[model samples]
Target: MSNRSRANRPTPDLSDANNPHAQKAQNFGPSAKRLFGILGQDKNTLIVVFIFSVLSVGLTVLGPWLLGKATNVVFEGFLSKQFPEGTTKDLVIAQLQAQGDTNQASMLENMNLVPGSGIDFDRLASILLLVLGAYLLGSIFSLIQARILNRIVQDAMNRLRIQVEEKIHRLPLSYFDSIKRGDLLSRVTNDVDNIGQSLQQTLSQAITSLLTVIGVLVMMFIISPLLALVALVSIPITIAITVVVAKRSQKLFTDQWKQTGVLNARVEETYSGHAVVKVFGHQKDVQEAFDEENDSVYKASFGAQFVSGIIMPSMMFVGNLSYVAIAVVGGLQVASGSLSIGAVQSFIQYSRQFTQPLSQLGSMANLLQSGVASAERVFELLDEKEQDPDPLTPATVAHSANRLEFKDVSFGYTEDNTLISNLNLEVRSGSTIAIVGPTGAGKTTLVNLIMRFYDINEGSLTLGNTADSAIDVRTMTRADLRSRTGMVLQDTWLFAGTIRENILYGRPDATEEDMVAAARAAYVDRFVHALPDGYDTVLDDEAVNLSVGERQLITIARAFLANPRLLILDEATSSVDTRTELLIQRAMSKLRQDRTAFVIAHRLSTIRDANLILMMEHGEIVEHGNHRELMEKQGAYWTLYNSQFQAPAQHESQTDGDHI
Candidate 1:
């Protein structure tokens, strides 16, 4: 047995079929069918590649036959050297037959020889040149085939990424409620990239390998049927080995990818809240969780690779055994005068070509399976139910749609659990309504409903200047509804950008003068002027470079610049210091004039001047009136106001007198 057998040559067709980074998959049966259906978009291109691959394989198979002709020229020359000039092979065979030497006479008859003929150097040279041309042409076809396959895979992957991105925007809020952001991100990124790479590595080479098998088998049968049958002994055994290994490796790879997503989610959570982990002394717990998930990924990866790694050496061993059988059977045919030396040489080569593709095919099962699994994850994201579509004919607005009424509105994240039920409320234009409530009281949810972030399960939420002009929020497109409203949340969200850029995000087309006015109104100009870069200073991730109050001011400035008729302030002053809070209050007072505003507050001090005050509990408005009237009622609003402010105000008042 040759040490460098052609059956296991590593000449780089796409890639070496040894170990791949992405693991094999378990669901190739159903998932693989859908996966290929997507890749079939470029049917014409695939057909062109198929034709090229067949031509390449056909040329490659012809090389061995031409070389066998050269072997005949050399063997016949060696036979001619054994006899005198002018003696023919028929004369020698008749003399041997008269002398009763039947064995020698039979061998001489099979020999393709004439007495006194030396080596036909001219024919040998011609056959060698033809073999070289065949090999060269096959290589050119192979290269062209590989380039086309590369384009097909890259274009297919690009479409998949776009599909994933568009699907994200169309998904309902409820779909996000129960899913992990990090896991979904992993599918969009890691899984999609793995599938692209697998296809790139397997496609061109797989087609070529299969065609080579068919072409080589045809040549082998033409040369000798008995030897061709002997060469095929390894097929059944190799298949059994693959099936056995496949069964064990499939689940191992599946667990590996699943664990990878879990690990990524763990890393995202811990990193996003690293400061919280340190403050609460939970560093050890975070590290422990990370280690657990990391270990799970490691174990799964190890088992998958170890089980699949056995395929190569096992297949090579089977091939070597087949090689031994072919040689033995072929030698018997030559000695019995049924075959010649050159024919046996050519049949051995055909056997090698046939078995190599089969071995290659066995290795490709890993990549093919891996692609199907990754495709399944991405397909899941694409197939999730989308949010309800926008209206076909949206409601028109003659004026600002500021006044909002939630009449008999009911909503729940899920159908079985209702968070807000049969809530009815109406607000006049140019009025500021302050909603005060304890935790889980639908304070934020009510504002979200106005913005149409979540559609109500029952009843209509309408908006307009008057009752007669009122339009159902569902009748308007989300863009038309949201464009007329602005929101400032307690949790400040500032991406990595300059102060000016962040302020202009809510109103991208606003003039520089308008942005500056909004900044000054929000008290953002007070600190921004002190910085060396002024409004040009760049913020890092999460805008960590700015102070808490400064970040809040920028968001307020963004909302101010929008100039929407309906403004939602959800604990907007919670992050600011006392003096900054006072300034924001004055700015908010000016912004609320001639506009409708919804203010959800935990601190009663900020909303004392609101036109209408509402106290909500368990999604119900228990008490509502102007501030002075609610204070006189001595009900839920009065009790909550006292509990939150009376004692703290008393202490501050007592200290203020002594300091003065």
Candidate 2:
């Protein structure tokens, strides 16, 4: 495809304003369903949690009921004089019996007999003990339930992180090109973290709160149906308010996350190119751009949080109103003698208990929304199609050969702009082919095709000793193809590890002796021996400790250790000094022996010894001949060589043999 066309391709929209859910339901793609599915996978744990949660609520109700009972006993014995001396023991027993029976005769028996003051103290102490026990059990089990739920959440999070990482590695390169690096990083790090936090803090709490609410309502209804109904009336109103607020904040949070990514990208870009910025005196301009993005992120985050913040207070307001209504109604019932003081107190306590969970649910709404937003981003990445599918039954090659051929191959990144069309090429075993081309002339693209980095859109690429029984490049596994192809690019990438580690990266199982031999051949051993730690010397990001020439030599050493049949050198020595270039040329000379090599170089002087040179222009071979034949033709190669060779001595001195 034309570079202009690719550069102008429409970017995908990630803005919250474009999403329908921003205006209505707070749903984030299929994340809601997928999250529920993940939670449902641990049904046993959830079920156990539900049971424990119910037990906890049951204990909570029992605590307040026991407290109310004890209060009534003390009041009757002390204030009302209902249980005076001598009859107090009987009164206590009768009270307990009445509580179990709930009949008018049992209560009358207690009122008529109880008169012992010491007995009243003993009964009150027993009731207090029961309440204490319920509280103790409730506290202990609540901790246990929380611990168990946390483990479940952590396990699920671990699984999710692994899945997301695997998906990231499997995704096509095109997908990466389409999305911002910072956004992907946010999805993996920030979004996944949000999901985990939500699970830990909000999801489990919401479930437990729900169980508590239901259990409280059941207890309240059992005590007084009228009071339970009054409490229930406020629930829907609280939920409606919470839902409306949550819906408003969901999109806002999504936008906040996206803005964070933009801000992160800006920071990453600036930090990575700090040297360039300083050289160009654009630090202020960069800072201004950063400030703009930072402001957007701050506004979005504050707005989302503000909307979410209103939910808890709104719920608390409704809960307080419900408490007042229940209090007034229950007091009237008690005063009219239809309800006991103990029963009215129990109903009021239960009403608060019911509202507590609803209050918690309201508070958890923000977390829920954030989790949904994060999940949507994560799932979107996971859902992207992979570049290559693993072969169901892979084909195997019995033997290795150096011959490579591209016959009538027509290919392009896009349909309208063809990079290579009707191109035919064949390389004999153990021969060097140098490809010379201007920028945008498909030089690197041709090498990319040969390595099967991309498959041809039309025609076949074959590799074998002969064309008759040639093996199609697509039929062979990518790993197998890559293993047999050695590549050295202009930019050398060294990971943060020991020098030996980087050298052996191409063949992890290579022996120390084999590594040293390859390093010696690539002229890397010369520099390594001078280092403080020899092969054990550690490298940092971009190997900033090493010069450009040294890094390139190390990369060459890695490729040398790979020892593949096909070698591709893409402007490999472009950034090195003249003396270092000579060393690299010597290494390349040894490396190219008996190998089918495709060398791309701008400096015509370096490839003079190549068996054949193909000069390319506008994705087509404009001239093809040996070095002398191209010079004799006085074509594109002649013009290029003359232009470069006629440059000032200083400019020529600055050039590394193969670099433009």
Candidate 3:
């Protein structure tokens, strides 16, 4: 079905060899089942396609039969030209029998020739016209069938695309962390697209090819059972060839697609980290890697196509042998007057029709294998377990439910590997709390739990109007909880849009005056006024046209625009210049006012004035107090704080004493 072997075809990813989806398709049976499941949703349309296909194929088979009738006319006209005038067919047979020509006598008895009649041109013309009409009607029906099939395929693919999008949204962040982004994208885009193309290319043709064969066989039998049997003999040979070639080609197809993914992944990696490659001077290494992957894909594809190409000629070989047998056998019968020459001619045509479709099916085998392999890859994604479903009815919470608490919270990313154990903490509605720790100290993990980016294995994370009136965070809808919370990370995200629109994304319905106020609060207005376009300056891809500090300020402005009840800042000023850092700190201070805030800081000095500070170590809270109180105790917080300020680890004690 897909004739352009060199053209880019769908390559379902197999880069992750251990992934369950990497397995290749083994049979058309499963592909048919999956395709039918999608088709069944529009049963009425398929019924229409089936009916038209039958009509189309029926007319196609009728063409040879009509041509046979025309052949009979011409043959009879020639014999009638030789017959004596005023002689009847009965008299001719009687005369032939008296002459001792038994075969002639038997043939004369079957002839429909009229005495003294020349060629009947009018009758011949009429029969010829009917043959043309049958073929023409068949073509019209085929066109209609094809049009409807395309529509059905397009609609089915649309539904599938939507399903993939929704599934991706429901998948947890951890799921993304576990797999290559490229592989997942292949499942979403290429795999689904290939399924649609494969179904569209193969579905109607497969149906038509099948129907044509059956209809032609019936016609052959009706004309002469002997010829039909001769043609039928090739079917076994055809099946054996198909099975042998298809089995091997399927494996090659798998290798082709697998290597395609590898090549694609290498390309993605090279381009994504081109700067790193350039700095390290590894361009030649990347080029070599790409060539290796590309060559593997090429060889695999060539092998699959070459092996599959064998089936076409193999089918033709069998069909030609059958054709020779039918011609020879029918000629003998015609000579004996047991069968007409026209019947033999029609049988020859039927033999050709039968083998042509068989050959086509052989060709479709490779395309079908590729398509089904992609379908299986996509199906695996669809079958993945979704995130925990939302509550049928969420528990209601008061408008002022901002006070946060974690009670008896014990959780881990995986079972048997607890990260936070028996954690307990509570915060008032309006408090700026800071969490400081080294890497892997459960600081960000704690923030992730609060934002519900991940559902904890065991924890009671709740928010309340007051300390005693708490409701579980899970009780509220995700949208509802997130709507009241906003976050700004150290690595800011600013999309490709105007500065105004970027800020407006946080609160779409905010007035212009309110937007400017937030922008001013985040010091975004200070930078915007300096630019020629100010608020309307369009950012480029990844907003790369702007400085990092400028991008960071825009995000902070966006968060401020939302006026969220709860705010989370991941060391907002850690990557900025000193002046920008001070500006951001002031902006955050204003934004955090009257809002419950959690600031995860890398620099301990930045959170010196926070209402409370928690020093975390190995998922445990080692110290908790105001900055001055912790410094007075000279414990874990004091030690960690002094470490950052110390000249070097070798002179840590004196630095600690001096700082204290």
Candidate 4:
């Protein structure tokens, strides 16, 4: 599939959805919106699980009602003689008949509570069994719903993690240059992890707590609306307190995450560059830097947690006050013969059920806020633009002997500083072209443009003969373009894998014979065979086990294996010893055969056989010609060659031509 198609596919926007700062208020409307969105993603599972949750909530209410009924049954048996001496039995029968207005009462009466009555003990045992069964069924439903919700959250997090990773891969390289590696890492790792945790712990619990509150309020109103109204007065007060605390906590959590990123960056830098620190005897300096960052992280985290911590206790205080108010009012009503003891008991239970979830929800507000902070960072990354759009409908390329051409190309990373302007060049197929210049002459930038790592700001680059037939690099797929190009750089990077794997990285489907041939050509086979495991030896981190020269050889071998139509060797032999440089030069000679090659080298001797040499200065070509033609001109090329290359040779000759 095309890279564009792969990138455009719909994925979870975890960052946007989870951002704490983005959520304005903790109202039921917004919470329900988020909840429904999550559920809508997998409606089938949500529907089934929601049904089970409702059944569980309904059954939970039945347990309290059943207990109340059983309590009344016990009280009636004791009060039977208080009704009237002779009419006691009649009164008892009348009470039972009145209570048997519901199906549950009928079920209860079948067990028989009348004194001296032939009550069936077996039936009573069965009624007790039914009560136990109801409780167990409710517990089972709760467990099932909890598990399903947890799975939904986990799956959503998984999808979000994958989306962030894909965005990172597709984002422009320039974006990374402007952003800290540690900060990006924190967003993907730390932020996403927080979201997952919040979903698992806070999200499911919040839902259950909300349902509990609603169910309890309904029950409370049924028993006594006057008492319920008194209890509910504390809600607005509690919410006001929660809102103020949540606002402060959100800011603190955001600051905490920012500080965490800074700390992570400092730690990563210190560890990664430990060798440099020790070599420079800067251990104390590094330690102080680390301590500063660590202190920042600690302070920010402590303040955020401390501020958020106040919410739970505050909620409890409000809840306790509300509870006392309900009790005082309820007791007065019962004393005045306006309420029953059973109704009072049920109302108190419902009040506790109502306030308990609200308190728990308050406690989890901080975690939810932290998750939001994380989401903001993740979304920022996802929203970044990709390097350049690949062609929606690309033009086909037919085989041709056409040369690569740069026509009045001007480029810059940013608008204020132009690297190269009105630059023009031509590189024929199967020709060796050398680009020689002083430092910062845009040599590497030119190479980057050729590979389409960055597009030029102005002008055009053509790959064919006719300007009308020229193909834009952006119009071609990156994978296809990269497959046709090969590069070997000064700082060779070998991934942590076997030597065989590193060499075959460019062409995973290559035959073993092809790999061996490429390795032999790149002169990498000599070192490989000398190792204990030959090509099977695994490389360590950064390939520190291999010498710099050996790493260069491996990279060269990779290029050879790919066998691209175009080759770029950017100071490939600069860091090696004389003998190794010779080996690399020999490998380059073979690799450059029948391919268009661009060589960027500091050493002038390496490019003496180039078909054409372009001498550059200040991001512009000053002179261009072959070795003899440049020497004959006695111009900029001659001046550079005599000073930089010839003077070194003359000095060496005076020292008996030492091989360097």
User: Model 2, range 1-660, lDDT digits (tens) per residue?
Assistant: 223223423344445556322222335546688876777778899788877777776787687778878767765665335445554555566665667754443444433234544237788899999988898898878877888888888888888899998897677555655666666788789888999898788876787788777777777887789988899999789979987898789889878877887777678768877999999999999989989989999998999899998998898899999999999999877655566677788888888888888889888878888788778777767777787775767665634667888889987766787888888888887889999978778887888788766678898888876666677778888877778899988868889999999999989999999999999987888888898999999999778889888998898999999999889998888878888788778878888888889998888888999998999887788888899999999988999988887776657677865485
Cα RMSD to native, each candidate? 9.6, 5.5, 6.4, 7.3
Decreasing lDDT order of the candidates: 1, 3, 2, 4
Give the clash total for candidate 4. Answer: 2
Across 1-660, the per-residue lDDT of candidate 3 in tens digits comes to: 011110112233445576554565345577658866987898999899999999999998999888988888898888888889799888877888898898877765666879789779999999999999999999999999999988998999999899889998887755655555666766777778878887888888899999999999889889888788888889998999999998898778767766665676677778867989999999999999888888998999899889989998999888889888988998888878888778778888988999899888887887887777677667777777777777889976766567999888886766766878889998888898999987778888888788887777776999987867888888878888888888888777777889999999899999999999999998889879888799999997577678888898888889999989999988777667988887778778877788899998878878998999999887788899899999999998998889888746657777788989
| Candidate 1 lDDT (Cα, 0 to 1) | 0.83
> Candidate 3's error at 261, in angstroms?
3.9
Please report how far candidate 4 places residue 316 from its true position, in Å: 1.2
Q: What value does the lDDT take at residue 521 in candidate 3?
A: 90
Task: State how far residue 216 of model 1 sits from its true place (Å).
Answer: 1.6
Residue-level lDDT tens digits of model 4 in 34-134: 53465468778878777888777777766665555454445444444344544445455556568764432333333324544333445445546666777
Q: List the residue pairs that clash in candidate 1.
A: none
Give me the runs in candidate 3 sitting further than 4 Å from their true place: 1-28, 82-109, 494-498, 528-541, 648-660
Q: Clashing pairs in model 4?
A: 19-372, 20-372
**lDDT, candidate 3, residue 207?**
90
- Runs in model 4 deviating more than 4 A are 1-39, 78-131, 399-402, 465-469, 631-660
